[model samples]
Target: MTEPIRISRTGSVETWTINRPESGNAITGKDVIAAFEAAAEGANADIAVRAVILTGEGKIFSAGGNVKEMADRQGMFGLDPIEQRWAYVDGIQRIPRALGRLEVPIIAAVNGAAVGAGCDLAMMCDIRIASERASFAESFVALGLIPGDGGSWFLQRAIGYERAAEMTFTGDRIDAPTALAWGLVSRVVPHDELVSTATELAERIAQNPSHSLRMAKRLLLESRTGTLESTLAMAAAMQPLAHADAEHQQRIARWRSS
Candidate 1:
């Protein structure tokens, strides 16, 4: 079988493309899920890999799950409900867990329709840039399912509770402009420019000191669930470490000489 994911490097930035356009980049299968988990781990272990861009092949960023398999009670939705629950715990949920632990920043370049779990995947990234052709939906309800992959948590955080609820309840897709207005994506570009735009953004981020970037990302994650006092305390702890990093020390030395 062909590789489900394609990871390529351009300077300090890596672009991770979902290569299974034939399946609409259905990602709930074991192979795709493991591919994602492995990609996250590889990036986490490599400090030289400064940034990442996530996108998909063909017209859809991803369709989220294998609908045929879901209907057939195969793959991700296989066996009994009890077994399927474990399947979810040991399968698709790993994507978020791995992504949450990623030290470097991630950007999603949404080239087209991002529906169901697909939209949630984009939300997993630290930043999102959508193509003018791009769209998003929390469309589990339309399929008679809920976002079995933690879309509930990520969606609300991206666009707030009310809007997230509206999308979730309606399972309606919002186009790129509306997504931007609602703050789902940072910006929208023409279809042909999505990759270049995302790469430029990733490259800009990669130019920063890697350790500082990781620390800043960590603090942002902490802020989501932490109280202001707790967030401040964490930042205080990380600030010293950032200041003492060799990269920072080198910059200070160079500044002194100049």
Candidate 2:
């Protein structure tokens, strides 16, 4: 069997594809978790990797959790509820944890249906670009399941509490335009142009000095829950290090000459 997650590099951008197209990229087992962890590790270790684009292969982005696994109580979702809880903490939960620590920027290229866990995965990324064919749902509620992969934490933050509440309660699929209207996605493009557009955006971001890029991402992530005073303090602390870098000096010189 081929690897469920495929990594490809182009310049400073790393692209991760959820490769189980036949099954609609249904997330399961250690493959997805290991993939996420590896992404974090590789990006952190390599200064050249400045951005990441995540999407699924073929048509469907992801069908969220494996329904067959859930039905049969196989893999992570065993017969016991406690076993399920442990599975979440040690398994799927690792995706969010690893992603949260990743300092490089990530753009979710939502090419098709991003249901349940898939939707949450997109929310974890710093930016999202959706194809016209893309759709989304907080769909676990329909199956009597909850967002076992930090959906509750990421949803309200991305689209506000009220919009998040509606999606979670109803479990209704929302099209790409609806996602754009709700601020869930930054752009909706023609299906064929999705990857190219996302790649262009990633390349633009990657052109910046890697150290400053990482620091800027770190500062923004900190600001999510930080007060104005605390945020300012963080900026003050970061400024000295940024100013000391040769890359910042060169950029400053170029700005002066222009």
Candidate 3:
């Protein structure tokens, strides 16, 4: 079988593409966990890899979970409810864990529809850039399911509680422009330019010193749950190390000279 996620390097940037377009890139069976693990491994293995761009092949970014599996009571939904609950704990739940552990910044290039868990996956990233054709929905309710993969948490952070509640309750689709207006995505580009636009953004970020980039990302993640005072203290602790790094001194000199 082919890899569900494919990782490639261009300079300091790593691109991870979801390759299961045939099934609309659905997170079915083990693919969701497998793909996320690959991302974590790829990012960790290469010290030179500075940034990551995640996009899906073909039209849809992802349709979320496998509808067929859900309906047929196969795959992750197999056996009894108790078993399925454990399946979730051991299966798709790993995606968020793997992704959350990645120190480097991640960019999600949503090329098309990202519904249900798919939208949550994009939200897991540090930044999101969507194609004009892209749409998003917290669509678990539509299928009589809740976002068991941290969508509730991610959605509220991305678009706020009011809008996230609206999307979650209604499971309505938000087009790219609306998504941008809601601050769900940083920008929306033409459909054909999605990958290129994301790549350009990743390359720009990759140009930064790798250690600093990772530290900055960690600081942002810490800010999500930390108090202002706590965040400030953490930053104070980290700042000295950043200042002491040779790369920091070199960049400072370059900046002053230029």
Off by over 4 Å in 2: none
Model 2 lDDT tens row, 75-130: 77764888777878988899899999898999999999999998999999999999
Clashing pairs in 3: none
Please give the RMSD of candidate 1 to the true structure. Answer: 1.1
- Is 2 or 3 the stronger prediction by TM-score? 2
Q: How much is 8 displaced in model 3, in angstroms?
A: 1.2
RMSD list, candidates in order = 1.1, 1.1, 1.2
What would the per-residue lDDT of candidate 1 be over residues 152-249, giving only the tens digit for each residue? Answer: 99999999999999999999989999999999999999999999999999999998899999999999999999999999999999999999899999
Instruction: List the candidates ranked by lDDT, beginning with the highest.
Output: 1, 2, 3
Per-candidate Cα lDDT values, in order, are: 0.92, 0.92, 0.90
Clash statistics: count for each candidate: 0, 0, 0
Give me the runs in candidate 1 sitting further than 4 Å from their true place.
Answer: none
Per-residue lDDT of 103-188 in model 3, one digit per residue for the tens? 88899999999988889999999999999999999999998889999899899999999999999999999999999999999999
State model 1's lDDT. 0.92
